[model samples]
Target chain A: MTETTLLTFLQWIDLVGVLFNAVLGAVIGRAARLDVVGLVVLAIMSGLGGGMIRDVMLQSGPPIAITDWRYITAALLGALIVMIVRVEGRLWDRIYPPIDALALGTWAAAGSLKTLEAGFGVLPALMLGTITAVGGGFVRDMVLRRIPGVLGGNTLYATAALAASLVAVGSWYLHVPTIGSIAATAVGAALVLLARWRRLSLPVG
Target chain B: MTETTLLTFLQWIDLVGVLFNAVLGAVIGRAARLDVVGLVVLAIMSGLGGGMIRDVMLQSGPPIAITDWRYITAALLGALIVMIVRVEGRLWDRIYPPIDALALGTWAAAGSLKTLEAGFGVLPALMLGTITAVGGGFVRDMVLRRIPGVLGGNTLYATAALAASLVAVGSWYLHVPTIGSIAATAVGAALVLLARWRRLSLPVG
Candidate 1:
């Protein structure tokens, strides 16, 4: 695919990721017995918070989550769907893992690309990419007064993000960012799925 | 005082706040039995996180924490002091509250003034101001797996920030931001002190 086409694809993935994460956030909020305001807050924060944090840290203009209308619309739609429908049990269990993994991959790729575009080095790109992938969940978990699962005892979520970021950065250095982004997403998502299947976890300190 | 003098004064307060917060963070880390690396991480985050969050959200330039040499130096010095000096017991108990309160006040004032200078309206100023005042402590609490004290059930820390921000914003409207900043700091610090003295707590939902 051409660069423009690849960029468009990444944007679409970012939007889809927002929608999925918003629904998941609402589900968690419901499980926590939160009120409607709390549910909406959680959904929006889980959908948009990571990107916001990344953009803010990049010192870029206002986050695209705020500048673009569609992002919030997608997140709100997700919240509405979760409030109206029962998105649980077997179907949710089967569907959530893959979608979540893909979201993480795409977000990491997008974050790394943006960091590179902003003229940062590889280390910053990798750090920001992982942060963009996991920051929303971190904020969500904090709001609920829980230890962030990615901090320890979970599958290799942060590591997968880091790997995806490294792949993207390497691709950027090789001057093939578009193809690298696609490869990074695939590698990241696959790693997440494999880790889950194998019950892989980093050892606790 | 002149605008230049006021600016200088605020900068000093900002630096002092970082030092105090870094020390506070190190104290907390010690209480948690964290290792040296963890203590340093907590100290830096507690010292600089709030201002960094505010500057990042402002999107005008790089965060002053990263750009300014003194901020990091102050934070590091704070960490070193706590690591070596055994900063607890009667001296800490007597000194901590007032210094902490003053830091909160100054941060809120600085945040609001900067927001207004960034051409944002009153609401953003208030929100960012409160975030600047409490964001570090909030992050510290989250990392420690505790609920942020400002969220609810504690003394009116967030409220004091809001009040200070409101005063600053109001002063900006009156075209006296320099004097307003000083007054806002005083009001915020006083409110915190009063809340503590009276053992006041917010109503929990």
Candidate 2:
């Protein structure tokens, strides 16, 4: 891709990710029966939440508080999309699991790769990877005054991020080619889906 | 303060801030009836939320993530404090709002002062001031899954930060005495209190 195309692609993906989360957030918020302000808050949390965590973990400082303002714009866009779309019914159910799965893998891959590019080591990269994939969504859920989705004993939320981070670490360790990382991430996400489909959990203390 | 003394004082104050937020977070998490892991997560969210936010807004990159793990240390310390203290009831209750207010004021003043020192204009400076004051708390509430305390129609959170920013900005502009900024900030906070008592609000769209 041309340089502009590359940048545009990344921005578009970011927007897509934000859009996905916004829709999910609104659905959750509606189920929670939150007010307008609450819905908006949840949408922002879902959209920018991971990036915020990634930024913090990367020592990049508050990304959204600065940046193109596009982050917030994307969040607002996502919120609007969800709000207008959800008035009818079931739009969220159509979107949630699959979009969440994609967001999980893509975000983890992006985070680990970006951290590596930023010259961090594998552990830091993985830490950031995990945070990126689940961090925003987690915060979004929590900020909506609910248990954070990732930690709420929900089906395999942070697990996807962890799987992706493992891929990042493994790729770094084996000095595998770039594509290996992506493949590993795909496998990890697929595993998350499997786990979710199986309702896999073991008793814990 | 002497350089060492100042650093120590700042760190001490920062520690106090961390502990304050930790207790507050634990209370909320416990009230929410979360598990230990959940409580830990909430504590982390509350403790570093503002400073991390100010860092992100400054685009300093993941404000707490870069250091050799100081943020983690702070988070743990805060959690430990809360854990040790929470054997009794309502300690967090007695401390929450007032400490939160102090944290907000400190961040707003400190952030605005830093922004002015960095040569930003008044608008950005004011904005930074507000973010610094409330950023962590906002993140805390968000992670706890509630509307941002700063943004929700509760206290005059943003107003206080704005007032401090104006003081910093006015001090920069007027070349006022060294303490003029402090005086202005006090006045601003007082105004916030007045607004709160009167149930005032910024104009809505």
Top candidate by lDDT: 1
List where candidate 1 sits over 4 angstroms from the true fold.
B1-44, B57-59, B64-135, B143-205
Q: How far is candidate 2 from the true structure (C-alpha RMSD, Å)?
A: 7.9
Report the lDDT tens digits of candidate 2 across residue range A54-155. Answer: 765576434652476777887787778766764434665565666667667767777777777777666567667778878777766555556675654566
TM-score for all predictions? 0.64, 0.60
Model 2 regions lying over 4 Å from their true place: A1-106, A120-127, A135-148, A166-205, B34-41, B60-68, B76-102, B142-148, B151-205
DockQ-based class of model 1: incorrect
Residues A89-138 of candidate 1: C-alpha lDDT, one tens digit per residue: 99999988998898899899989889888877675687678878888987
Candidate 1 has a TM-score of 0.64
iRMSD in angstroms, per model: 5.2, 4.3
